[model samples]
Target chain A: MLKNLAAKAIVPVGLTVTGFVIVCSILLYSYVKQDLVADSIQREVLLGDIIVKATRFSMLTDQRESLRQTINDIGEQKGVEHVRIFNKKGVIMFSSNDEEVNQLVDMSAPGCIECHSGPVTAVHLGPMDQARNFVNAQGEPVLAITTPIYNEPNCSNGGCHFHAPDEKILGTLDIGMSQAPLLKSLATLRVRLVIFCLMVLVLTVGGVIALLQRNVLLPVRQLVYFADQVSRGNLEINEPEGTEELVSLAGNFKRLARRNLEADDSLRDLQDKLDTLTRQIREREIGHKSGN
Target chain B: MGFLRNVRRPPDTPNRAETAAAPGRERIRRLHRLAYRGLWGMAAFLALSLVAFNHGWLLPPISDGARAVLGKAPPTNLISIALVVYSFSALVLILSRMSTGQGKYKGWSHLAYLGAFYVFYHYGNALDANFWAVFAAGLTIMALEHYQMWTFCTEAIRKEEERLAQAERLEKFKS
Candidate 1:
């Protein structure tokens, strides 16, 4: 098998491989890049879903402690790394584990001076963290979620609970989730992807090699077999289906073999004819001498 | 190239002169030459990993910059694949150069084994049936391979020769 592959791949198989390598390298390069980004984005989206669900549940319940606790429980899931919550003011009201959220935070402001729209960290969301914003720190990503605490309407009825109207600005909540486990899982996925890519390249190239192996090896072997028959002065072999080029080649080889055979036969026949003539002439000469 | 080209002809045939002068010896020479070329091509392919997988620090730095930009590197995917690809291409280049002269041997079946190996190696870890299967298949090809070559070198000459004669005669009649 090795020899056959070696033989067949030596020709078109090898060339195909070279072309495939060049072509696939470029393709795989781009694919790998897109694959990485897509993968990270997918992970982030999954975590984001987790945060949204936790926040939504807390909003329905109307309890800060329960909301914060629920988010914490979900963050500590087998794959969840960290979780944190922020209020409408962008204050880190509650955190999974990071103690940096003890300071005052305000999210009512417009854009993030650093990562206003995405995962980048540079904007100030708190008075204490005005220098360094509430971004991901030490492999732990803090997802800022802002929720409003409404004042009871009955208190503003001038009877039971509230005092004024908009003065019921309760508190803010913040949540941060560690990205380590998620990143780690993604790393594993990347390894698997690499392996899968390797397999694909290998199998595809291998299949090509297998095809050429038989195509080149078999026909050439047939040509050789045909040649061997003619080489020994045997001129009765039919040409193998060596295609136009090989068929023509076989035709030439056969012609040469037959020509050599005919030339040798003709020369032998001529030698015999000369020997008989010489014998007859010598006999006649000897007889005349004896009679004289 | 020498080894592949060499294998296309038998050692005893040496050259066309010998082919004309002594056909028997010529056949032997061609056989040897073909074997030699095949061997040489393999030798070159085996040497590819030495350069591609050298792991030298200067071999070519991967894009740490891409990692920083994307927040993560591609996890050795590109480098490992580049290595495998380089090796496969080396195999192709060496073989093609050697076998250019062989029209019959220029087809694809002979190369099937290499491609199979590439696939096998890729999934060997995942599938767990890699080396053994490859070895078995390779050994099978080896067993059945030269059986035909020897037969070709010895027996088929006479039949082909007769066809060649008739062909030449027809050509002469046409002219």
Candidate 2:
């Protein structure tokens, strides 16, 4: 079967198609994965904003205990990694974990560097830039969103507040969520994509082989048989069937065979005539000799 | 056997050629019965592809089967399937014509397989089993045609070789 012409044609085609499917599937899966990651980050960013707003009243009223409780409650929620509110000086004023409160954080951290990476720290950053992804101390993937708190007029004008009106930024709200959900989604996507790719490859290649076997290989074998018989001078053989070209070729061969038969018939007729003429001449010679 | 036996040849006449050729004629007839059956098989496959492609009555089973095997929702866009079918069929038709020529075998023409793959990828969401089914059927048809043509040519060559060998033997005998 390997030596057959159909195999020679189909093996290369199947390989080429498999290569194409693998490459295209990988590229497509990567594209979809990137979108899912970005979407996950976007969701984290939105959640950060909502948490910041929920704690706004407590922060404005100087309710440090209430704000701390709110942050802790949010951190205890499912998939919530941590929630921290930091002062402009990078001091962790209120944190979900008590151990982290009052500790000074580095201004150039993954969650902070997006805004503080420049020569001067940025007063405001877009939601996308505010979101950052990293692995936490436990080696688990995390998506963190850093929302800067802008100084409002009420804060500076209030009796309990000492913030200057000129201060454009007050502090930052940083929240991190576990990336397990997003990773699970991505993993599922990858599996589905791979399965889909393999399925397509198999169907296409399998279909090709089936079609080739029926249309090409089987027909070729039959044509070879037809030719073998014809070559052995079997003009009474049936016409082989296949593709139009093969059928046409078979028709031509049949015509040629018929022509050969006609020529042979003509030869046989002339031979018979010669035999009859020879018999007549011999009989005449015998009669003439006898008469002499 | 029937025709040659009915001929009014002499009882002592040498029937060397007919005696040599008659053995395999029955086998050839049997093989051709299979070829005719294959013609019917091709027709059935073509009919299946058409049913698989159409959106009307018979599509659901084919589509569902494809989906179950695929492990996901298959693409259902008629326009994309139509485009792929059109382009792939046109390509095979051209290749078939090119293959019939006695010129150099264009191995490069097989690159069209890659092009078809790319087209599927470009319309990735629209690539489905129905499109592939149709495409595979057309390709198989063309490939079979080429295979038949190849066998026919080879058989002709073999016959010519035999003739040449016979002529050489006859010349030696005459000399």
Please tell me which predicted candidate would have the highest TM-score against the true structure: 2
Clash counts per candidate, in order, are 86, 1
A85: Cα error in model 1, Å: 5.2
Model 2 bad stretches (over 4 Å): A1-3, A228-237, A240-242, A272-292, B1-175
Interface DockQ of each model? 0.03, 0.02
Return the number of clashes found in candidate 2. 1
* Candidate 2 clashing pairs, residues 3+ apart or interchain: A216-B144
lDDT of each: 0.49, 0.67
DockQ of 2: 0.02
- In model 1, how large is the Cα lDDT of residue B160? 45
lDDT of 1 by residue, B89-143 (tens): 4444434443443212321343354444433343222112122223322222222
lDDT of 2 by residue, B7-85 (tens): 8856785455434444444444444443344345445445544554552454333355664665643233444344445
> Candidate 1: where is the Cα deviation over 4 Å?
A1-80, A85-93, A98-174, A178-210, A242-244, A288-292, B1-175
Q: Tell me how far the alpha carbon of residue A61 in candidate 1 is from the true structure, in angstroms, after superposition.
A: 14
